[model samples]
Target: MSEKSRDINFLKLFGKNLRSIRESKEMSQEEFSSFCDIDTRQLGRIERGESNSTILTVKKIADKLNLPIKELFEI
Candidate 1:
């Protein structure tokens, strides 16, 4: 209904999709974060939709997961 709401919804969806993809690969948050060289707490926040991630960070995650960046946003 509002721009802010839309953004929040997008973040939630992205987080959900990311979490699903990560879990599907059978990787724990700690393991994936280690592989991606990202902070585990930050990854947890991203997966919970509690924070917004930079494109660079997203790219790093995609690269580590061997997935296209766009796939992270898929519903």
Candidate 2:
């Protein structure tokens, strides 16, 4: 399909993976956000694939989760 469509799909998949990881860790969005020093609403937006995240933001998430950066991109 189109480039935009591919980007959207990537975002959705990333969000789904992130949500799964968080749930597996038994952390609520609020708790994860606080630990990551991020806003809860913004974390929700990211998890919902409603926002485009920067590398830095992703790094922060990976760091907070104690996961490798590459793991964040895993489907």
Candidate 3:
């Protein structure tokens, strides 16, 4: 796949996973960001697919939320 297509797919998946997990944990963006040590603005960007997070950041979020990265994409 082209880089653009890959980016689109990945971004969509990431955003979807973020919303699902946040809801599951009963976390508002502010709450989740506090748990994950990220700013609410950054979390909003992530949920909107507007920011590309680093692997370490993603891992921190997954750990903070008590989820595996794979489970983050679960439907």
In order, candidate lDDTs are 0.89, 0.92, 0.83
lDDT of 2 by residue, 8-43 (tens): 889889999999998998999999899899899998
User: Candidate 1 residues 1-75, lDDT tens each?
Assistant: 999999888888888988898899899999988989999999899988888999999999898878888888878
Best by TM-score: 2
List of clashing residue pairs for candidate 2: none
Error of 1 at 8 (Å): 0.7
lDDT winner between 2 and 3, please give it: 2
Return whichever of 1 and 3 wins on TM-score. 1
Instruction: Tell me the spans in candidate 1 whose CA falls farther than 4 Å from its real position.
Output: none
Model 1: lDDT of residue 14: 84
RMSD of each: 0.8, 0.7, 1.8
- Tens-place lDDT digits, model 3, residues 7-75: 977887788788888998798889989989999998898888888888888888888878787776564
RMSD of 2: 0.7
TM-score of 1: 0.93
